[model samples]
Target: MRALIAVATAATLAVASPLLAATLGDDGLHKTDWMRDTFKDLREDLAEANAEGKRLVIFFEQRGCVYCTKMHEEVFPEPVLSDYIEENYFVVQMNLHGDTEVTDLDGEALSEKAAARKWGILFTPTILFLPEEVPEGQSVSQAAVSVMPGAFALGTTLDMFTWVNEKRYELDGDEDFQRYHARMIQERDNGKTD
Candidate 1:
């Protein structure tokens, strides 16, 4: 009976492996190879991201966040989304309630939780996209070019990333995120975009 149970457990684990693929780091946040482990200094992190020819994106999450888990497990691992993010964005994970020290863009050092509060981050899995050139003395919230405040499907998430990457936010008149996303969806449906 013991041997049979062991074999069944192995089978179950094998079948369930995909659901377990999002590995948790020691800090309890989901870990990805593309997530750069940094000192949490926003200014230095931004500079480093710019040096890499990528946008700096801050991901705010907390332990046991269901939406965070959804993105990690269902969305991020998808090659189309993951590859784009890994190639075009430098991702920094911030714990919504963690005590880890983080330096804000304005040179204010505070705990991760405090930084979240200061940034007015009210939702888990919020993604803040920073422009390449942030004015001096600006806070993260003020400097963000785009802020995705809640969970979204792959298409919406990918569109947000693409819009930011292409700097569509800077375009004059009627090409904001909503319009851009609508265009993308239409193109995708018409087999004009991936």
Candidate 2:
């Protein structure tokens, strides 16, 4: 009976462990099942996302990023956020200091590091939310509808994604992200919003 109980306990703990905890790639970045391995072409990624009825999201991360680790271990592992992201976004990961080639929407080909420099990305876990269509001659930096630059808790993270997915930024600037986030928080606290 003691051996059986020990086995059961081990199985339960294994099953309950955070799935993202053990998915670190050789690059030392956390990998998720939803992260798509792509050619790093913004235009093609957007097209693919559109075809899948998903949004295009660019994630900038680097080795030894503590905030990235926090996000992977805590925020993203939450089932609600993970399920929403997996279902609605085509996420492309970019190493902030890597040499992987990337093609910008404005037809600029550059290494990942250069692209980060060009995009003015200075932090790990900078998430770019791209619009469905990019204007001609516009770079990803210029065309991105929203950019989340740091780790956030579940409520804020979900609200950010939800706001972007709903295209609230296009509403004549009536409700900016801060306002939208505030309202959403209020509603959630009141148990009146999703």
Candidate 3:
């Protein structure tokens, strides 16, 4: 009887331990004060970023988008990527199909998902890097200057991250971002560090 009781106790603890670990890990992943979970809040966060002199990185994603899940699970959790993002950007997560009210910087209330449509955010996991503030009287309907759609590998993602961090878009003119990106790849392969 004593042996049986001990075995049962051990089995219960083994199952409970995994459950406790999973809950703790989830709690840790969501333990940031500035992480916005909705599109509306994310738009508002852009203004906060502008006020704080931080760049805005808006991640537009849709339900059932495998690439979006991959980005969230793989890219965002990467230690180096997370560190860079936390240091340089105000990150915003937006659901492409959810209906929610979003207040723009100008205090206009619009459907958050509708605004995404107006901005041509048709793809899942589109990342927009906003370096400058939208002008006071300007509209959010304007297209982002830099948009990267689809999933990206860590190397490509890191390259883009560095380029945006250093403001290379200002120097590379008329070649388009893809061409500039290619140049970066070449330079990197040649052991050139920028």
What is the C-alpha local distance difference test score of each model? 0.91, 0.91, 0.65
Candidate 2 least-lDDT 10 residues: 185-194
- Writing each residue's lDDT as its tens digit, candidate 2 over 82-188 gives 99999999999999999999999999999999999999999998999999999999999999999999999888899999999999988895689888888887888
**Candidate 1, residue 81: lDDT:** 88
Candidates in order, TM-scores: namely 0.87, 0.89, 0.69
Clashing pairs in 1: none
- Can you write out model 3's per-residue Cα lDDT over 39-142, one digit (the tens) per residue? 45445677678777778777666666778666666666666666677777777666677566766545567675876776678888787777665666445545
Better of 1 and 2 by TM-score: 2
Lowest-scoring 10 consecutive residues by lDDT in candidate 1?
A: 14-23
**What tens digits encode model 1's per-residue C-alpha lDDT throughout 29-48?**
99988898999998999999
Give the C-alpha miss distance for residue 95 in model 1, angstroms. Answer: 0.2
Residue 71 of candidate 3: its Cα lDDT? 66
Lowest summed lDDT over 10 consecutive residues: which window, candidate 3?
19-28
